[model samples]
Target: MSKRTAIIDIGSNSARLVIFEKTSRYGFHLICEQKSKVRIGEAAYEKEGYLQPIGIKRAYFTLKSFLHTIDKYQANKTLCIATSALRDAPNGKEFVQWIQKELGLSIKVIDGNKEAKYGGIAAVNLLPISEGISIDIGGGSSDMTLIKHGYIVDTYSLDLGTVRLKELFFDKGVNPSEINEKAKAYIQHELEKLPEHFRHTLAIGIGGTARTLSKGIMKQVAYPLDKLHAFTYNVSEHRSYLDAIPLSSAKNLKRFGLKKNRYDTIREGTLIFNEILSHIGTETVISSAAGVREGVYLEQLLKKDNLKFPSRINPSVTSILDRFQPLVNIQKNQKTKRKLASNLYTVLQQDINDNKQYEKELLWAVKLSSIGQTLTVYRSHQHAFYIAMQELNHGFTHEEILLISFLLRMNEKELLNKPLFTHYKPLLPEKSTLLWLSFIYTLTVLLQEASNNAGITFTYTNKTLRIISDKPLYLAKEKVKALEKPIPFAIIIEDESTLPKNKKLGI
Candidate 1:
């Protein structure tokens, strides 16, 4: 356990604060969060690109509330940052200073490039973006970052946002051809300014614009809420959908299923997205739920750890996995055991079933758990756990990494357990853990195939476990320990040294 921290992101269209529960001495939890659509970019871009007094007041009020929330949580540290809206405003600095004085909240107004970086870093934390561009179209500006192999190669903030376009062109809600023309020109100019080397085969979407579109798609198709995670959309289909949502009623539009609050900005967001696609010649979009706030969270982790990024990877994942790398060791030895354990808990699925992805995740854990061991020797289990959690750089949730490590530990001990391992029971319930543990706590002698490491062999007979052997059983003793745990159960060991007879040994 570690101190909790709070992060506040003041974007062009909205403001939000999330309290991240620090998991390890350095890990973070997206414990809880709150958001509001303040339209600061609308205010900034409306009056010749200056922060309007009204917008400033709105932001001040929002920050005041966020500060109270953080205070309520007893968070030890806080950071507030403003993006495109403030960068476009002449009075942005003054507004920040005012907030600093009025609510005792210091706000840092960052430029567009930094905003893009934060967005890209957050995306990298979720899915590996091998090569792509990220576009976050806000109320007043669109941020673009070119990423190749998980690194930010270039960034540009274009002065083209949904609110700004609506204000500049849609006089009395008319589709001003000139506005569209200017938007295209602005986007093209910004794109041209980007390094020619940054063109990508893929594109990642972040910010409110992309998020709102994903929600709209979900509403349009009646998608189930559960798989709303990392949703993917075709650029053309999204563009067509945006085209269907006529411009006039965009602000007060009623799309039946979607939240009313998000209606106004979607049109503008869609327009900007279409233009970005045109500029980059990309027809793909991967929407990410994580953005600057998570980036801020990752930044805090790296700074605290003093961890260096591998020359190849974004430092964000490095800092993240450093706290969870110990869990990958038992992937091979514990999987079938895990599957056996999982089988025992099938009847309980009425209460706690897993997703289709869960088993794959478990299998992945089994394969990767022992990656650190040069050989399957005495301390290999311990070495494997260390490598999985500490040496590996695979981007995973801190919780996921820890859970895998906890499962890996199940394969090493005799009598099926250790005390520190119990902390997991609260998270993974007793039935599930025991089933997984019992399956893993299998004797190699009884399951003779595993003795010569010929291969892993497993079978169960109404609470009894067995393994077929390929060698003499004398060397099978140490391997038996991994198979014997949480007992008052049954065990059987057979070897050629024992005169070719089926035997039974129960403990």
Candidate 2:
């Protein structure tokens, strides 16, 4: 029997539950994740910075749902933590007592510093190659942590986050100058406590505020899937963009391409964001998809000395192949197609390996491009493409998942007139992204050859890729036309006796 553990994070703005199921291998898989945007901080700010009964009621409901989930999963252990809004409330202790007595759920109200610590642990899980300051901008507060050599160096939690900032600054209808004066002073005072060693470090950000900023950049450049995960934006670039927006209405903000729900709060969010960046002399903001709840999971993981803290997501494509094996009869063909893509991946690792994630997602899409046949036999390529792009989930963030799905949905023709993923282009280096996607697509169609029975083997060198195959009458000539697009290297096809002139293919 396996043990399942659950963690509930009841924050000021949103409440979340993350469950981990430990299998026989002793590694835990993310079993379920859910959140409720209860806006607890809104009420806390309204009732003179205290949580109102209405807000508590809504939060209790959310916590009850989490309880049901834990019961359903048969979880043996559960941990619950509440931050900023609850800690600040006069009746917060009573609230915790109320939950324990009424719902039979134990809870802990974590201080700002501890919140910073757990958020740091979670950020450590996400950024394996980075040593930096981790930030989680919650609805009520922003938790900051400095990590070096896998140990927490410094930590803080400021009363500045999306919900709290919006309530205290923007939502009050205060003029921009007055708001900036108050928030800037608060932030500057908070920064005085940060150790000097953390200054100018890479800023790793977690939560909605960070993701909202990332999505805007994604939509701006049409940044494809690969760039979305570890995408970096410096303070200057982000500040200028935020400065231009009025942040009054979603429509006014839509021109910036942020989600409608984000615009009302993002102005204050960005202000606090820029303030922290300037205070710490941060070089860049690395958006981390995991946050508090993941930290709760990591805490349990760390206790066993088998810490996967510094978590790295396998390329979406590789993760899918490893987890969801292709259907029965087609499994063999899928394996061949994957091996073929891997061969190309090995050949081009030099010019293309800046991001293994983008490559893995592409090749993974290619491998399963044939999996949609369970629905019907006809037009499986379209089905497969749709499924690969739209349906698959590899714990991808909202933006990256969207980019991957969009890339899969696009076609060669779609590539010609302003590509669908073009919105994210400005945020990323184009040559690497376009090259990765295009090569993966080309290799996919080549290997599938429209699912023919022909035997083919390809040998790859730094400059060229060689294919040996006997032409089968079953495939369409247009299948070869897919490779006619402009590519840098050459592809040559050799016959059994090596008789036909070596074909030189151009990108």
Candidate 3:
């Protein structure tokens, strides 16, 4: 794979270009992305699927502009794939050849199965989902893939989409009731083509319709985090709103917290999405920021690695660490902190209740604890917290991401910030669990800093925490004495060799 690669996805509703820069093998991030609402299948659906001049002109110009942006970035390689729009169009091949002849670009027209597989690959690799049906609803087709145990098991595509339905029913200017009744029956008829096995309780939503709905739900519920990827909501809770979208008038979309740009196709998209969810027995929806573009990139990037990232490797985390913590010693130091934190957590596990469950998050927090120090030493905790909140995005749930942020934000003076905690309280673990993890993480970091990277051990008994070190931890004793405890507990520091013991009073 090239060091810098650009992926172009031409869909019925839009054409998008994304540039990804690799920092390491299996470590990459999006450097730039551009999209145009070409609606290439604009009037083609009603004309026996013939590419019309209006939509063809829009797509041709969009692709031309995209190439300019790709050249500006000097992307080493470019891969372009066209989805439902081009595949369903009678002149799709002519358009592809025309682009090759004129703009020196080649576009691969993928069938519905390939489109669904791409979506599945992206969702499985990027989102924290093992089993679900990845749905990519476009302007002319609804592609789906069944993912189980981190692999795509099956894929299928239906001749149902927003633009297809809009042109078939909505644009006819029929009354909303009659249009919806006709659209629902038509959608159901198309959904019957889906494989009987393409059902799951969780749905991985890909593309614009899913994202728009997720954003609106976030606004409706006042979700704190501004992120769209991996944002999850229960279908039963929002079923009414989903059903109401297609019936909403253009002027009333704002009540659902929708943007005007999406007003053109949001209704049809929502109708298709809602019907599909019901058909597949979907209970939850996890929105994905990645789709065919990312899938196309990853398919090529991980071709040698079985089309999946190596086990236990998260691309986002690897990319951040590769960029920020380049030195071996700094990485070694993080490892050292992780070891100490793990040891402390084990010793104190019996007393912290179910906090043992958060040990994974604790380890990740420890690994990334020092990244902010590279930016500035003063108040690095806040910097680390912000970075974790933003960069620890892919392959992580919202709760896990928020928990890691709170862990990274730990400081000696404060165990937990009240305002910050209160703001994201709903997305976090219980107060007790968070405080325990924070206490353990903060103590481990303090010990490593004060001991000058010396060996350490821990043993907790009878409501007292005992830390034994290979050398005298003089700085550690004072820090421990002034530390804030999550619960009523005592901490004692012991020097390994001979000397009067330094008695540290626990707070």
Model 2, range 1-507, lDDT digits (tens) per residue?
Answer: 237888888887788898877643324557788888877767567667777767888998998888999999888899998988888888888889999999998889998888888777776655543378887888778888888866677887777777776766667654666667776787677667766676756888777777788878767766555434456667666666755553334346777888876766777777777777777887778777667776776676566654443243333444344444345536667666766666666666665665455655655556655455556657554565565554443344444554455444434443322454465454333644555565556555554654464456666576566765554323433444445443577666554345455643221
Candidates 1 and 3, the one with greater lDDT: 3
Q: Answer with 2 or 3, whichever has the higher TM-score.
A: 3
For every model in order, what is the number of clashing pairs? Answer: 26, 19, 0
> TM-score rank, highest first?
3, 2, 1
Q: Write the per-residue lDDT of candidate 1 for residues 114-175, one digit (tens) a residue.
A: 88778776666555456688888877677777877666677887777777766765543355
lDDT leaderboard ranking: 3, 2, 1
**TM-score of candidate 1 against the unseen true structure:** 0.65
The worst-scoring run of ten residues by lDDT in candidate 2 lies at 309-318
Best candidate, lDDT-wise?
3
Task: Assess candidate 2 and give its lDDT.
Answer: 0.66
| Candidate with the larger lDDT of 1 and 2 | 2
Candidate 2 wrong stretches, greater than 4 Å: 1-6, 17-52, 65-78, 121-129, 147-154, 159-173, 213-231, 243-267, 301-306, 309-319, 327-507
Please report, as a residue range, the 10-residue window in candidate 3 with the lowest summed lDDT: 498-507
Span of ten consecutive residues with least summed lDDT in model 1: 441-450
- Highest TM-score against the true fold, candidate: 3
